[model samples]
Target: MQQSEVTESNDQAALDAEALQQEIAAAGAEEREAVFRAAVRAQAADVLDHTTIDDDSNFLEQGITSLKALELTRNLMSLTDVEIPLVAIIEHPTPRDLAAYINEAYAAERG
Candidate 1:
């Protein structure tokens, strides 16, 4: 193959690798989010059983108080081995937001 063709092939390979990495990261994020949501549901089972918990639903509105949030954060930390600040639950009130935050923090810690 010509030198230019070889370079183009290398570039394509790099792009493919990058794309695959992104897809993997996205899949991992989705899985983490699912797990986080499950944990939240489990923790709030008493209150959530009668209500639907969507991604955007407010945890406070669902009866998750500050003390409950602390307990939930502790549970998450034990499950994920990531240190989540107490304020994180307040800042990222919903499971979706908290999951994203935890995933990002986990990735950063790994890096």
Candidate 2:
């Protein structure tokens, strides 16, 4: 890639990081990323490679493969052991959406 492309990618990554941090904070404990947690951070880091993802980004449209999805699912399961339906992720592609779904699921499980 050209120098300009590299610069753009870096800017996008920064934006993504900021968006993610805001989302995590807004989600609170139930949906928070727990950055100190290795597994959660690793999962977030893995997905961060797809810098094109925005709050409204479509994971499927952006070529998020089944394997990557599975990996994310596995990582999440390791943390919460909640069996999130694959279709849920397919339907809610953005981090904010996924965070909302996970929070709801966690609440339902608790109550």
Candidate 3:
């Protein structure tokens, strides 16, 4: 990738991070999970360069390469300012599962 492309990607990632935070924060307790799942779906789609991804679709099965998994992990960490390991993608393997972990992290951050 060219320098300009890298910079653009970084800027877009920053914007996505901010949007993810806002989306989750705006949700009430009962809606938090749904909101988080949506955010996770968006992140996965962004990292995979897809327009949309099913919440329960296995990431690896969807062709998420190691590099894309790393990008997804970074995006999730940025979204919540939480430290998530790279293996999280393998363990969670789906937006729904990852959302649960991310929501837990967000709640912990609030505590």
Global CA lDDT computed for model 1? 0.69
Off by over 4 Å in 3: 1-16
Best by lDDT: 3
For candidate 3, the TM-score is: 0.77
Query: What TM-scores do the predictions have?
Result: 0.61, 0.54, 0.77
The better-scoring model by lDDT among 1 and 2 is: 1
* Candidate 1 positional error at 111, Å: 0.7
lDDT of 1 at 31: 78
- Model 1: lowest-lDDT 10 consecutive positions: 42-51
Q: Which stretches of candidate 2 lie over 4 Å from their true place?
A: 1-48, 51-53
Candidate 2 lDDT tens digits, 44-63: 44754643444455667656
The candidates, ranked best first by lDDT, are: 3, 1, 2
lDDT per model vs. reference: 0.69, 0.60, 0.84
True-structure lDDT of candidate 3 = 0.84
Q: What are the candidates' C-alpha RMSDs?
A: 15.4, 9.5, 2.5
Instruction: Give residue 4's lDDT in candidate 2 (0 to 100).
Output: 100
Better of 1 and 3 by TM-score: 3
lDDT, model 2, position 22:
54
